[model samples]
Target: MRLLFVFGFFVTYGAVLTATVNNPWPNFSGVIILWFMIYLITAPARRRREYWENRRALQEEYWRSSIRYQNRYRY
Candidate 1:
């Protein structure tokens, strides 16, 4: 299922991050910050994408229904 896939992805990422932290270049803090930033950027980007997609579908439906109604009343 989708949940399983998501869980697996996080587990894999966490393992890699653990390794990165263990042998971070110069320091461990930057790797942690980079991972946090990745989550921040990706979460909002996915949400914004879904919001726009729904708005586009609704606009298309409105236009289709308006055209149907206008055609029904034509002389």
Candidate 2:
């Protein structure tokens, strides 16, 4: 489901961008900026940051526990 959502989003974005790219770059960039702004506006900034911190902490813990899984999951 998440894959579908992501795929659909990219497909829509690429279709729009390519179909209208000759229309203008600034307009495309503006839309990109607006997309991120909307995302940030709706996202819980503090909670998301905390979630990331917790995620990193868990990753570190998991790495310390097992070198194999640690290497497997590294960014």
Number of the top-ranking candidate, with TM-score as the measure: 1
TM-score of each: 0.42, 0.32
Q: Give a tens-digit lDDT track for model 2, residues 9-72.
A: 7545754665554665335564566566556664788578889999999988977889787587
Q: What value does the lDDT take at residue 66 in candidate 1?
A: 93
Residue 7 displacement in candidate 2 (angstroms): 40
**CA deviation > 4 Å runs, candidate 2:** 1-43, 67-75
Predicted structure 2, TM vs. truth? 0.32
lDDT of 1 by residue, 35-70 (tens): 566667679877999999999999988987796766
lDDT agreement with native, every candidate: 0.68, 0.67
Residue 19 displacement in candidate 1 (angstroms): 5.5
